[model samples]
Target chain A: MVKINGKEHEAAGKTIAQLVLDGGYKPERVAVELNLDIVPKAKYNDTVVKDGDSVEIVGFVGGG
Target chain B: MIPSKEEMFAALAERHGTDMQKKLSEASVAVCGLGGLGSNISIALARAGVGRLHIIDFDKVDISNLNRQQYFPDQLGIPKTEALEQTLSRIAPYCHITADTVKLTPDNIPSMLKDEKFICEAFDKADQKAMLVNTVLETYPDKYIVAGSGMAGTFSANLIHTRRVAGRFYLCGDEVNGVAEGEGLFASRVLVCAAHQAHMIIRLISGETEC
Candidate 1:
């Protein structure tokens, strides 16, 4: 199982791309940092999620 | 002898009162760009009691800036930071100030932001804003940089909105909406965005909010 926003979820062999889609966010607008390393947008599809992996997704907002 | 927190607060209160003296004595901030947004933002921070301020601006004051910039007409042709330093010193006599009359590029941003708890991005160009943001994030991931955009022309005060874009990176003013090229800005909207930027910086510094 993986935790997202502090909620436990069944991993079930999901890829990073599917997890982002399941989280209800546009992948392009958000950056994914997994285990202290940034995962480029181009690799979202190839990257797979594993148990105990910490993923942080940040989105852009208007700022000066 | 070391003073207790209460004693220190009381001493500050005697000079600037509890509200302002307390806040100004606790903050260290940097303002990049001394143009329309930077000019007003620096003044507000000084008046609000930010303890230390670092101003960076390469441009010089011109006759045109008198309409919006707080600098006097006599300051024409002087570096923007120099002009702003004079004004800020008078407003916050006890505050420490460092003025840099140079552009904020990737090469020098690291040193410019050294020891600064908060940074205000008040540049006029989008590329400059992006450069500063990228460099700061790459170098100091935890440092907060509050940026402004789309404050180009005369717009209603309500149009300005301050939104958090990322951890320690906040965007203020209209985002997708902006004034067209060649348009002139009014004092009302410029000051509105400037106030929001200053307020956000204060909130971040005081730990009232996380950027």
Candidate 2:
């Protein structure tokens, strides 16, 4: 089980990028934080999800 | 004749406790927007005796800004950075203010705000706020980010809060209200969140863990 934005989900043996896309967030639109560190945009696919891993996906909003 | 700095900050120093006054006199915080949240938050911070403020914005003060932003009728059509400078200077003559006119992007936000340990993200847009938060947290883990969200409608004042969203991020707002509600941004509610951010900065500056 992996935690996405603090919610538990089954994502074992999946790359961070794949899980992110499956979660309905576009690769280009959201920032991905795996565990405690950010997974740079270029390295999203290489980073895989494991049990107990935490992921935070935050999208950008229009600025004032 | 040049007036002494001590005399300029006399009353301000008296208002702040001795220890907090010393720290406030030496602390600097970056305000990332100059609209409703930025304008109000900047004024609150300046009046609170924060030693220095670096305010950045590229938009001019439109007539619409008068509704919720902190500015007088005479400030319409002037750049927000310039307008805010005028207001802050009057609030605290000794408070150092650097007003920069530039469009802040994710790539450049970190550079422009790199020097400040405490950062206030007061953008009207959620994307800009999120980008700034992610970039700053990733690059400068040591710094603190005071961000706002969802302070749009004239809702219950009790809904507004300063929540520690992350280890170094204190988000102040109702968190879901926006222009979509059709109520629009009101000054009183907006200031509630802005003051929350300002107070959080003061708390962090005075070496407190709670906000």
Candidate 3:
């Protein structure tokens, strides 16, 4: 099991895409970085998140 | 110590030590817009011993500005730049202050910001803010500007965030919550945003934080 945003989740070898979909957020609207490196958009489907991994997601909001 | 700029420097040297006092004497900053956030930022900068300050604002103080602008009632009709210049002189008499009562536009942004190391984008309108940012990005890539947005109405203090989006440019205030056109302003949100801007300015000036 792993924690996503502080909530415990069962790790089933979930890809980044699947995790984003489960979290109800649009992947295009947010940028994800694992271990301080940005994960390219094209690699979202291929990249996998292991247990106890930390990910930071920053979303774009409209601002002047 | 005798009572003068030299004497003040001597007194500050005794308090903060000579090296810190010398750094304070070498700092120079420019603040745009003399309204709410700008007013608070200018006061804080002056108090913090920033050696030189350039304040620019074209708007005149109005009755509505009394609530949160930090100007006295008698200064209602004076231009904001002039009012701030007078206020800062009384607050930090030894610091050098320059006031420009002119509006900033694309045509004059370069010359206006040439001498300023740090600029506070305190403009009230979104168009002006965008213009300043775009102009700085295009013309003067080296200059740093701290900008603010969504500082209106009653919102919790937790909503404000100070973030750096690029080199030498930090955006403060509530980006998610925007103030609608013609909406009335509140003191709490304005002060909160102003404090964030001032804090970032101090951090950048003191070398405690980098863009």
Q: How high is the CA lDDT of each candidate model?
A: 0.74, 0.81, 0.75
Query: What digit string (tens of lDDT, one per residue) describes model 1 on residues B1-211?
Result: 5555466556767876677666667788899998888999999988776788999899899997776778898899989988899888777766789998887777888887988878998877665666676567667867888888766566567888887654667778875434434557666777888999999987876666654
Off by over 4 Å in 1: A1-64, B1-20, B177-180
lDDT of 3 by residue, A1-64 (tens): 6556456688548887787777775565444555434456667799888877656543333222
The stretch of ten residues in a row with the least summed lDDT in candidate 1 chain B is B175-184
What DockQ does each candidate score versus the true complex, computed on alpha carbons? 0.11, 0.34, 0.07
TM-score of chain B of each: 0.88, 0.95, 0.91
What TM-score does prediction 1 earn?
0.72
Candidate order by TM-score, highest to lowest?
Answer: 2, 3, 1
- Candidate 3 per-residue lDDT, tens place, B1-211, comes to 3368887788877876787677777888888888888998899888777799999998899998887887998988989888888889887888899899999987898899899888898877665665666566556657777888777766688888798754565778776455444445677778888889888887886676553
Cα shift from native, residue A27, model 2 (Å) = 6.8
Task: Give the winner by lDDT: 2 or 3.
Answer: 2
Give per-model TM-scores: 0.72, 0.87, 0.73
lDDT of 2 by residue, A1-64 (tens): 9988789998878997898788776455456677757677667888888999988775533323
Docking quality (DockQ) of candidate 3: 0.07
Model 2 bad stretches (over 4 Å): A13-32, A38-46, A58-64, B1-4, B180-183
Error of 3 at B150 (Å): 1.7
